[model samples]
Target: MGKEFIEIFEKWADTYDSSLTKDIEYKEVFRGYDQILDSVANKAFGEVVEFGPGTGNLTVKLLELGLSVTGIEPSPAMRKLADEKLKGKAVVKDGDFLSFTVEKKPDVFVSTYAFHHLTDKEKAEAITLYSNLLSSSGKIVFADTMFRSEEEYEKAKAAASQSGFHNLAADLAREYYSTIPKLKGMLEENGFTATFTRLNEFVWIMEGIKLQ
Candidate 1:
């Protein structure tokens, strides 16, 4: 499944950014992301490590804030695009979030529209890994598809399928959508204080601060 996930992104790399930008729903999501990420920038500290930085859209914004960013992207093609977009402003690493290692603990760890690629268990494990990689005051900020509950997720999946959004239906079937309440519980269980900001019914930004 992991290899397949990587392959999917690799295949979509060239068209990924364009597809998101051209889709009205995704365009609105990106706009909301801009605002959410801007708020993240205000709270960031020394250095930031971004997971799956697709084509450097949010990476550019973090760079503009004068923050040093290290981006981990699994797809070579996508990494290449991000490298070109970042233009030496940030370091692009060829790896996935779950296995990547950092010599120094980052002050902030962030991801946008990326975590949904993982399954629920993987998401929990990733959060645990992130907690271990942060200092007491460090934070983790994420912007992605966040559902209110399992019921809401099911309803959305049904709606998408009925509307001919097969890809979305597939994602739902694969358990790629995160439920906000579940996520917050996981974060808190792992010793982080969590907060959520909803952008819409399906998208949200979350911040978790390591407890002292």
Candidate 2:
């Protein structure tokens, strides 16, 4: 689903980590990055299939938590960096949200900062695919940008633009970021009990546990 942004990711592979720490515009978006990764790793168990494990930041945390992780990423450049970082600790594969292969069924599907790459419809389809692939009680833990309402989203975009953060503003306008209500409804409709926690002004943690 997020394959459309592969070129951007490829170009970003080298400076991606630095951007998280030094990019003024993205500071708010990645405010609690380490904490968010920790929280996601803490909630995951058993085998994990991680979507968009760019540079293997979350993948490293998952391994540190004693969990086996398979990282699926679409950008070869990003995957290369992740492989170098992981050093063969976890399998980083080439895949995206809607297409991937796992040798065994995963107990958890985890992602961070990447889900917004998919449009709402693609997001729903991805969730449905995960729901069908997972066993009862399996989980999806994702931390990404989501607004509480469309009004807030528009306001944020406007504020960014007014603040001279045209890149950030453009990103908000270009991405398929969804509303909390829409995401929650999608999870529920797919038979998952969903919970959300606000991590920052621009990021939220969404946990969905399959009920059946």
Candidate 3:
């Protein structure tokens, strides 16, 4: 399933940005990024790392803020587009977040609409790994499809069905969506203070601050 998804993304890489602009839901998702970035606007972060940066939309924003950014992406085609878009502004690497390495520990980590590709257990492990990659005062901000509970997942599924998105609804009803409470627990247990805000019915932004 993961490989299949990567293949789909690779195929869509060239047209991803243009396609996103036409998607109303995706536009709303992009709007959530502003809030995510604003949440840490006051922080003094020297370095930032992003997971699956897609075509560098968010990477451009991070670079605009004058912070050095390293983007790790698995899809070669996607990385190519990101490379062309980011150019010298950011270092785009060919790797997944779980195994990617950097010489310098980042002051903050950012990922938008990418983490949901992992299973529940993988998500927990990823958080643990991220915790180790951060400086003592470092933080992580992410926005992705998240549900508060099983009930909310069911509600989203029903709404999707009513809107004529049968396949999408079924996918939402399955184990794809992250559970907010579980995510919070994972972050906290791994030594970060987690906070969550709903961006929309299907997306949520979360910030996790490393504990001293």
Candidate 4:
């Protein structure tokens, strides 16, 4: 993500939430983020952090788990949405996800429906950054519908080339990142144990637990 892209998104920040959930279909799909958080409530996550918490959808749910949460969102409009929904429950910082270092590393760091927005290089870099912030036994969970296999990605790219949705699909093509296998490898190489496993059909929650 560059400064230019950040500025571009800031312009759309006000209406971005509307774009994501204007229709009933989108509303249900987006809620998957919250459901992911709920599913892991009993995992005993300590202090938590959520990156790219657009509209505070997951931020609110994470706080409800009784874990102190710090949500970092770059877009002002998105942060405002988080503020309105979170209501002082969690700390919200308006900053970039790449280098927003905190004084204390949180026990659990999670993000929902936002990781796809990063470039492949950034995605790999993110795993490194998040790994550095973990406690010895810290856990991380990344939940998104955007993860796709290499074959599916190739098809999507081909479809985009011939279809009128060139721009829209292009974003999806890049934003969705890779399938669970690639993601798992990245996590493991970065010192995370285990790998990506299926949590469900529609949802993919790849986790990494730091080795003691």
lDDT of each: 0.81, 0.94, 0.77, 0.69
How well is each residue in 140-164 modelled by candidate 3, as lDDT tens digits?
A: 8887888889788778778778877
Assess every candidate by TM-score.
0.91, 0.98, 0.89, 0.79
Which model scores highest in lDDT? 2
Better of 2 and 4 by TM-score: 2
**TM-score order of candidates, top first:** 2, 1, 3, 4
Greater-TM-score candidate between 1 and 4: 1
lDDT of 2 by residue, 1-212 (tens): 47778889988999999999899999899998999999899999999999999999999999998998999999999899999999999999998999999998889999999999998999999999999998669999999999999999999999999999988999999989999999999999999999999999999999999996
- The parts of candidate 2 lying over 4 Å away from their true place are none
Q: Cα deviation of 177 in candidate 4 (Å)?
A: 1.8
Residues 37-154, model 1: lDDT tens digits:
6776666767899898888888888888888888888888888999998888888887776878666679899887888888779889988988888877889998888888889888
Candidate 4 residue runs with Cα over 4 Å from true position: 1-34, 40-44, 146-148, 156-170, 174-176, 197-203
Estimate, for each residue in 90-127, the C-alpha lDDT of model 4 and write its tens digit: 88886655867565778987877667667667778988
Best by TM-score: 2
After superposition of all CA atoms, the RMSD between model 3 and the true structure is: 2.5
RMSD of each: 2.0, 0.7, 2.5, 3.4
Worst-scoring 10-residue span by lDDT in model 4: 23-32
